[model samples]
Target: MYFSRLTFNPLVSHQQLAQTLLQDTYREHQALWQLFDTDPNAARDFLYRQVLEQGRIKYYVLSEREPVDRSGMWLVDVPKPYDPKLVEGQRLFFTLRANPVVTVATAEGKKLRHDVVMNAKKQMGFDALPPADRLPLQQIVQDSCVPWLQARAESNGFSLEPEWVTVDGYQQHESFAKQQKRPVRYSTVDFQGILTVTDPVRFRTALFSGIGKAKAFGCGLLLVKRV
Candidate 1:
């Protein structure tokens, strides 16, 4: 074996040190097992955990699982006093999903633009929203659309009243108003646009005309460029 058992301070609290080492070793074993036994998302998450405080305690190779051949008994080999510890847990079996990345950030199906309202509210954490996740999509639209519409109208020289008693009452009749490029004051709850999902498998079948509520699609976000 290329690795040796790391020496621990015998003079210090031996029980505490042993427990720490054992726990650390167990986590490594469990994490490795999950990479194979669970979904790919679990495997991905397992690899990026925060660094252990006791990273110095080296791992020694334990006996690998071998086929029982003709002898119908599972045999456990004794490793030369190694640090690789055992962990106990029910092995979770989950069927992995298809491409879930498209839901979060994609140009197709208006996902990126549509998700902007949700994403911003998640960041801001408004008191009315209360912990962010509880906010409904409809409320987000109301808060966002009003401001954007007002800004859009003002830029073209039309004045939009904040608290309007009626829907259609802001038409200027003078040349002064005509002199400026006043946008037509028309409001609708509909903003329709199509975004492209580059993935053929995702675009052709799973993602279609409208929104769908489906979870557990094997997906995660990656940023190649440093923000």
Candidate 2:
């Protein structure tokens, strides 16, 4: 796999393109798509995360093959040992930006998807009425998203230390896709945790496949480092 960072140009129009990368579901990197033998539209074998640093937009991407690029973007590829073996009981510090959501069957015999933190708040009986005083909803976000992540870890070949897991940078995102008529809405949760690997293969799978939804819109990328 190849890990890369692409820095955006400083122009306003170029910065707008950066925002397009952040919000859009269908990516437009033709060079990245060319890396595949089969149709990239069909394969879709890549993941990415975008962030801002020093007022500049940057993208971190992982793919099965190295990507090609042209002018107007500074690209760097990170080199790593090929197929490094993983073992059980190894510990690592990890960060993930994910869309944590739950699907519920409604009274109309339909299913609705909800942000996990908001769902937690509702389950805690906060939905009947609004709080009179100003409240930091993000605090409730941490409380709600932690257990959801913990449950995911349990089945994904790792276990998180209850005291070590943290959730922050909670925010909602809404966007329109070219293929869809309506807008798509979701919430993003940033999680940082120390995890112990119980199953190496499963852990690797989770690292590549990601943890939750809205991956195409910059959610569900799990980055890890050795402790």
Say which candidate scores most in lDDT: 2
Candidate 1: lDDT of 158? 28
lDDT, each prediction: 0.29, 0.73
Model 2 TM-score? 0.83
lDDT tens per residue, model 1, 1-227: 11122233445475545544344323333333332354433422211111124654332221222111121111222334312221222111111111111135445645442233444465567556656456665665555544543443322222334343122111111111122465322112322111222333332222211112111111111101111
- For model 1, which pairs clash? 107-195, 107-196, 108-195, 108-196
Off by over 4 Å in 2: 9-40, 70-74, 78-84, 127-135
Could you give candidate 2's per-residue lDDT for residues 77-182 as a string of tens digits?
5534235366899999999999988888889989999898888777777766567642468778877788888889867889888699889988887677556888
Q: What is the lDDT of residue 84 in candidate 1?
A: 20
lDDT of candidate 2 at residue 223, scale 0 to 100: 88
Candidate 1, after superposition: displacement of residue 168 in Å? Answer: 17
Candidate 2 local lDDT, residue 18: 57
TM-score of each: 0.20, 0.83
| lDDT measured at residue 139 in model 1 versus the true structure, 0 to 100 | 64
lDDT of 1 at 69: 16
